[model samples]
Target: MARAGLTLERLTLEGAELVDEVGTDQACVRRFGVKVASLYLHVKNSQELKTGTAPLALEELADRAADALAGWAGKDALTAFADA
Candidate 1:
């Protein structure tokens, strides 16, 4: 059954978190307390959720890299990126 107050955006975000914690397992739907059909209303399937999350994860990594590289240059920037 669909839970009250659930939204597609929330589902997507939670799905992303789930992926980070447990990988691309479709069985993670059980953690959401909703049927697989319910998830379809928000995402096409587990693969779609995984696909949608990849860009977000990449963007976050890019942001962290940018922050780490800020005000640094040459070997320092290289070192920062490596550490980050």
Candidate 2:
């Protein structure tokens, strides 16, 4: 059965943390606190998680930049984004 709250986003974030903590080779479903064979439905292995985290990281950075630049424009926005 599918876990009640399991989703790609949570898995991606978890994978990112796992990779950061233990490196990609060690970032497996064990971190989910279960055997988690079902995790294969979302990702085949750690390499997929590593690749998946890239887009998540990019999106987060984009969102933060947008938020930080929400009130600025032109050179000010560029500077804020650079500083961000």
Which structure among the candidates has the greatest TM-score? 1
Task: For candidate 1, write residues 1-84 as lDDT tens digits.
Answer: 556766666666776787778775465467777777776776667677777677788897899999999999999999999888
Report lDDT (CA) for all predictions. Answer: 0.75, 0.75
Give the TM-score of each candidate.
0.71, 0.55
Which residue pairs overlap in candidate 2's backbone? none
Cα lDDT tens digits for candidate 2, 7-81: 777888888777668876345568765555778666677567778788877887899898889899999999999
Deviation from native of the Cα of residue 64 in model 1, angstroms: 0.8
Cα shift from native, residue 32, model 1 (Å):
1.2
